[model samples]
Structures are given as structure tokens and as C-alpha cells.
Target: MNDETIPQITDSHCHLDFPDFEGKLPDFVARAAEAGVTRMVTICTKLRNEPNVRAIAEAHAPIFYAAGTHPMSVAEEPMVTVDQLVALSAHPKFVGIGETGLDYHYTSDSAQVQKQSLRRHIEAAQRTGLPLIIHARAADDDMARILAEEHRNVPYACVMHCFSSSADLARAALDLDFYLSMSGIAAFPKSQELRDIFAAAPVERILVETDAPYLAPPPHRGKRNEPAFTAHTARVGADLFGLDYVDFAAQTQQNFDRLFAKAAQYKAAA
Candidate 1:
């Protein structure tokens, strides 16, 4: 397809602040624009790194950001307060609350701390009205339970980033009106089951991401991933939902506008 004919899409979560892109940010963002990726939400998983990550977004017109203490870093970093996170949201380009949620896959030892951090982020999301960017791994049960418990107290919007979890957890998120962001993992040829999970989801509740500097999709699977690869995963999403590239791209773009209202308004006002 020609560049002019290609529909735009958003990479809802990524990590461009990591060393993997050191001196190549402008080139990386240019490549993403060429791929029809008009916007990206680069996540700040640790509060201490928020300034650096926020700088990257501020420097690049195409990039927006979110920040909070990541679950794996919960034990290492000082606890983040809801006031601190709400203050971060005051920045024009700060769009979401976290890459925070449960991640027992590697950090089960700090489950207690992780849970506390997750609630703190959830509270911040509720207080700020920004959609929570979640990262759930092997702790599905706790993830579901805590999210539900928190929602009962005060509702907040969220998206399960890089969703490769089980059907039950997917249902848990969907039941709570949360979105599911498709990543390179779902585009792997061996992931038919994961494709099926997304296929069953409402088209309007879907978003796409790269989580880059990681999860590079096929043909580039073993290599470093970047925002430009978001289109590659979106292609797989089109196939999963039995739609053509343009239509699927439009659908997901509308989905992103609804969930990331701050970014939508930022673009409109800019």
C-alpha cells in the first residue's frame, strides 16, 4: 500500500526511553510516521525515570507518555502516592497512569508490595481520570480480584497492555469495560489461541502497541522492536477480526481516541 493511502494507527504503549534507541529517536519516530503510526504512548514504568521518559515525549511531537512505579520495581522504589501521580498528569503530554499491575511471572517475591503499588496507581487513575495502563503477567487471579475490588470503590478506565493472558482474565478485563491492546505476541504465527481471544473481543475495545525495545513481531522477532513495528501487529489484528487493513486501522484509531481522550484533545488543540 502507498503511504498516502495507508490509514493511521496509534501505538498505545512503548518504552522509547530505554538505551536501545539512544541516539536514534528522530530516525525511529520518522520510521513510525512512515509506517502510518501517527501517535505513540511511551510508558514510564518507574517514577524515578519519569522525567527522562517525559523528556523524550516532550521532544517528539508524535510521542505522549504515562508514568507510575512498575510492579517489578515496587520493592526497589519508594512507594508512589496518588497525589504524586495526579501531579504528573498535570503535564500536557502525560496521558495515562501506569505500566503498573501484577507481574508474578518474575517478581512474585514482591507480590505484597506489587499489590499495594497497583492499588496506588488505580487510585491515581481514578483521581486523575486518566486511563490506567496495566501490565498483567502470571498473577491473573490477583490482578482480576484487585481490579474488581478497586472498581467497586471507584471506577477508572484501563487497558491491559500486551495482552497475552488467558481467556478468563480477558473476560475479567472486558467485563470491567477495560480495553485489550494487541502487541507483537499476538501476531506470532504460533499464537492462534491468543488471536482467538482478541477475535472474540468487541472491535471497539481494541488498541495496538509495540512495547518496544522489546516484543518485535515476526521477520523481526529476535531483533529489537520499535514503534514502527506497530503496523506489523495491526496487520495481524486485521486478520484476527476478519477486516481489511484500512477498516481495522480506522476501528482501532477510534478506539484509541475514546480511551486516550487526553491525547485526542491534545491533538485537536495543537
Candidate 2:
């Protein structure tokens, strides 16, 4: 299909600054546009890499960014402060607070520090009025508890980026009016369980992503991923939701604009 016929969508999460896309962002962005992925949020997983990630966003009009010390890196990197994250939000293209949350899959040993960092990012989200981008793994209990607990203290928006978690965790996030981002992982053949979880969610709360440099969905599975492949994952979401591709795409666009209001405003003003 041509661009006008292809359903336009946003890759609500990705990592354009990773070495996989080094010196090749323009081509990737072009390919994404061709695939009808009109916008992308490139995530910064470490505080030190914020400048590089920010530069990627600054260099590409279709890109925006979010930064935080990822749970896996919490022990190795200095802990992030709410003030530092709030300050970064000053940039027009800095759109979200984190790719933060608990990840017991590999870094379970640093649970305490990860929790501390997650809370700080949550506070930053609270302070900046930006959605907190979360990366939850095998730590559903703690992740849900902390997020719900903190939301009670002061409400903040969030999206469970690249979400492939338990139905319980999904419900917890949805209960707090948060979003669940569907990545290429949900398009995997064996991801029926994950798809079922998403199928049970409110369509208004669903978003889509590529999580580029990883989880490239079928046809490109086991290969390096990119924003262009977001369409593959989104097709899966459309099927799961029993909606036509265009309708699902439009739903996600509305969901994205609602959660990432800054990026939506930027596009409107442009």
C-alpha cells in the first residue's frame, strides 16, 4: 500500500541512539515514514546517554525522547534524581520520565536500588506532568505495588513500555489510568498469552511501539528491529482487538496524543 493508504501509527517507544542505528537515523526515520509510522519516542536507558538520545530527537522532527536509569543499570550507574529528570523535561522534545521500573529477570540483586530509582522517576513524572515510561519484567508484585502506592501519593501518568507482563500487572496499571504499549514481542507466534492480556484491555488505553534494535516481530524476527517494523506489531494488535487496521491505528494515535500530550502539542503547533 502507498503512504496515504497505509494506516499511520506512532512507535511510542524505541532506542534510536543505540549502536544498531548509529549514523543511520535519517534512513530509519525515512523508512518509518514510508511504513506510515509517523512518529517515534526514542528512549534513553541511562542518564549519561541522555545527551546522545536528545541529539537524536533534536536531529529528527518525527522523534521525541524519554530518559531514566534503567532498572538493570541501577547498580552500575549513579542513581537518578527527580530534579535532574525534571530539568531534562525543559527541552521541547523531552517527552517522558522513564524506561524505569522493577526488572527482576536479570538484575534482581539490585532490587532495592531499582526500587529507589523507580520512585525517583515516578516523582519526576509527578513533578514534570510527563508520563513515566516503565520497563517491567519479572517483578510484577513490587512493580504494581510501588506504582499504585505512589499514584495514591500524587497522581502521574505512565505507560508500561514494551509491556509483556502478567494480566494482574496490566490490570494494576490500567486501574491507575495508565497505558500499556504493545511492542513487537506481542506479535511473536508464541505470545498468545500476551495478546490475550492486551485483548482484555480497554482499547482506549492501548498504544503501540517497535522497541527498535530488539523484538522485530515476524518476517523480521531474529533480526535487528526498527521503527518501520512497528506496523508489524500494530497489525497484530489490530487483529487482537478485532478492529480494522485503520481504526486500530487511529485509536492508538488518540491514545498516544492523550498520554504524551507534549508530543501531541508539538505536532499541533508545527
Candidate 3:
């Protein structure tokens, strides 16, 4: 599609500070803008990295950020607290609370620690009224149970970031008004099972992401993924939904706006 017809896109999730693009970030950012990505959310996976993440967001009018620790590292030194997360998120540019949740794919030995950390992150999300960015892999049942258990006391919006779990889990999140974000993995040929879930999800609940410096879609598969590559995932989603690229892009942008309501501030300026 031409620049005029390419719908303005928002990468609801990405790590702009990831080492892959550190020295060449400006060029990548320029290319992403040229590719029609109007806004992006730079996710912070560690409280210590929140400053760098926030700085990136602060430096770019179109970039927003989140504050929370990755579940895999929760048991490590310098654990994050609800107060710290709340404080870090006070910045006008900070709009969400995570990159949090269980990741059994990497370390299944500490399931309890992961669960506890996820609870803390969820609590922070509730305390701050910001959406949670969940990263669940190979632990859908446990993630669902924990989310359901905490839903009563710490109700808050959520996005199953980089969703690669079962359709049942997606249904549970949607039933709770949580959004589901699709990353480049959704565009992989081996991910047809995942695409089936996306195909069945409500368009209003679907958001697009690149999860950059990681999960680059086909053709770009082996290279670093970036916000500019989000368009491909959007294209794949649009194709699965039987809609044209423009319409699909518009729908995902709308989904991003509604899910991360604070994003509207950046969108308006864009």
C-alpha cells in the first residue's frame, strides 16, 4: 500500500531500548515512522531498566512506556514493589504496568516465584489503574487461575502480550475485558494454530505489536524485529480476518486506542 493508504499503526508493545537497535535506534525509528507506525509503547521488563525505557518514551512524542519486572527475573536481586511501580508510572508518558506475568518456557523450576511475582505486578496494575502487560508461555492454566483469583480484589485492564498460549486462555482474557496483542510470531507458518485464535477473536479485542528486537515475522525472520515490522503482522491479521490492510490497520489502531486509553494523548498529537 502507498503511504497515503497505509493505515496509521501503533505498536502496543516493543522494547526500543533492547540492545539490538541501541546504536542504530534513530534510523530504525525513522524507518518505522516512514512505514506508517504513528506510535509505540516501549515496554520495561525490569524496574532498574525503567529509567532507560521511560527516557526513550520521554524523548519521543510517539513512544509511551510501562513499569514492571519480568516474571523470570522477579526472584533475582532488586525485586520491584507496588510502591515503586506506582511511583515510576506517575510520569505522564508511562501508561501501563508490565511486561510481567509467568514465563514457564524459560524456567519452570520456580513456578511459585513466578506466580508470586505476577500477583505483585497485578496488584501494581490495580493500584495504578494501568493495564497489565502479560507474558504467558506454557503456563496458560496457571496464568488463568491466578488472574481469575486476583480478579476479585485487584481488578484492572490487561493485555496478554505476545500471545502464544491456548485459545481457552485467550477466551478467558477476553471474557474479563482484557485485550490480546499479536506479535510477529502470529505471522509464522507454524503459528497457524495461533492465527486460528486471532481469527476467532473479536476485532475490537485485537492489538498489533512487533515485540521488537525479537520475533521478527517471515521474510524478516532471522533479522531483528522493530516497530516498522509490525505492519507485516497487521497484514497477516488482516488477511486472516478477510479485511483489506487499510481496514485491518484501522481496526487494530482503534483497538490499541481503546485498550491503552492513555495512548489517545499521543495519537491526538500525532
Candidate 4:
């Protein structure tokens, strides 16, 4: 396919506000745009640094943001209340509600705290009418149950970001009209099951992400990840679906727009 045909993607999750990329984010974002990454959602891991996350989004027209504490980081600082999340998310640059959910992978003792935090974030999502960017690790059952119960009455937009869970969880999320975004982990040799899940996922519900400065896909695994490197994830997804890189990129880009609905408006006004 020609350069014009290759989709201009959105890095659905990244951390431009992280300390490691502070002074160097401009160049990193620029390089990503040059490589056809037209938009990115800089995820927030802490509620206190929301200003910093918003600053990055404000600096770049193609960048958007999500506001909420990560499950792992929620124990750190000023606890984010549902009201606070709703108010903070009123900013135009703020497009979604979370990197929030259950993660028992590392700290199993904090399950209750994470669950409460997840509920607060879900309430914030319901109040704000915004999409949610969820992070689920070893707590797939809890994740699915919360989503199912919470969504039954008040259906809200949500994406299971950086998914590395069971097929049952994947189907449950999709059944909730929640989008499933794949991260660089899908590119690993040990992740064939993940690739199969990606292939079986409805195209409209599929999105591609980097979860950058974290999961850097093959050839760059264990190194610092960035938005530009998300192309490797796109390549991995394309290879899974038996499509060319550009085609798969286009498909996932469309899914990203639909999942993060405000992104379309952001792009339109740009």
C-alpha cells in the first residue's frame, strides 16, 4: 500500500507526563506523527499530576488525555473522589475517565482498595458521560463482574485498555459494548493466545495501543516504549489478521475513534 493509504493511528494509551519523558516529549510526539501516529491519549496514573497531563495535551493538538488514578498508584497520594474526577474531566483536553481497575498481579493485599477505587472511577464515568480506559491484571473476574453489574443500569463508554486477560473477560467486555485495546504484549511469542483473541475480536471493538514507556513490543521489549513504537503493535495485529500493515492500521484507527468518541471531535476541530 502507498503511504497515503496507511492509516494515521492513535496511540490509545501512553504517558507523556511521566518524568522520564518530560523534556523530550515534543520530539517523541513529533516522530510519532511523522510515522503516521496522528493522535495519542496520554494516560494519567496519578490524579495529582492531572495538570501535567493536561499540559501535554494542550501543547500538542493531536494529543488527548484521560484522568484517574491507576489501580497500582491509587494508594499513593490524595485519593481521587468521583466528584473530583467528574470536575477535573470537564476540560476539553480530557477525553476519558481512567487507567483505573483491579490489578492483583503485584499487590494482592490491596484488592479492596483497588476495587473501591475502581467503583469510584466507574461512578465518575457515569457522571461525566465519558469513556473509561480500564487496566485489569490478575483480577479479571472482578473486572468483568464490576463492569457487568455497573453497566446494567447505566451503560457508559469504556475500553479494557492494555488487555492481558482471559477470553471470557474479553467476551464479557465486548458484550458490554466496551472496546478491547491490545498493547505491545500481543507481539510476544508467548502471547499466541492473545493474538487469537485479537483476531476473533470484532473489528469495530478492537483498538491498538502502546501503553508506552512500558510494554514496547518485539525488538524493543524491555526498553522504554513510546508512541512511535506502537507501529510494531499495529504490525503484530496485521500479521495476526492476515492483512497488510496499512489496512490493519486503518481498521484499528477507526476502532479507536469509535471507542474514544471525543477523539473524533478533537480531530475535527484540529
Write down the lDDT that model 4 would get: 0.86
lDDT of 3: 0.86
lDDT of 3 by residue, 127-164 (tens): 87788899998998999988988887768899999998
Write down the TM-score for model 2: 0.99
Q: Which tens-of-lDDT digit does each residue in 1-270 have in candidate 1?
A: 788987999999999999999999999999999999999999998888999999999999999999988899899999999899999999999999998999999999999999999999999999999999999999999999999999999999999999999999999999999999999999898999999999999999999999998999987998999999999999999988899999999999999999999999999999
Better of 1 and 3 by TM-score: 1
Q: After superposition, which runs of candidate 3 have C-alpha atoms over 4 Å from their true positions?
A: none
TM-score of each: 0.98, 0.99, 0.95, 0.95
State the lDDT of candidate 4 residue by residue for 1-270, as single tens digits: 445654688899998887779799879988887778878999888888888889889988888999888888866756779998989877887889988998898867788888888888999899888898899999988989999999986889899998889999999999988898889999988999988988898877878889988989988999999998888888888888888887888888878777676778767876
Error of 4 at 69 (Å): 1.0
TM-score winner between 1 and 4, please give it: 1
List clash counts for every candidate, in order: 0, 0, 0, 0
TM value for model 4: 0.95
Clash pairs for candidate 1:
none
lDDT of each: 0.95, 0.94, 0.86, 0.86
Please identify model 2 stretches exceeding 4 Å from their true place: none
Residue 268, model 1: Cα distance from true site in angstroms: 0.6
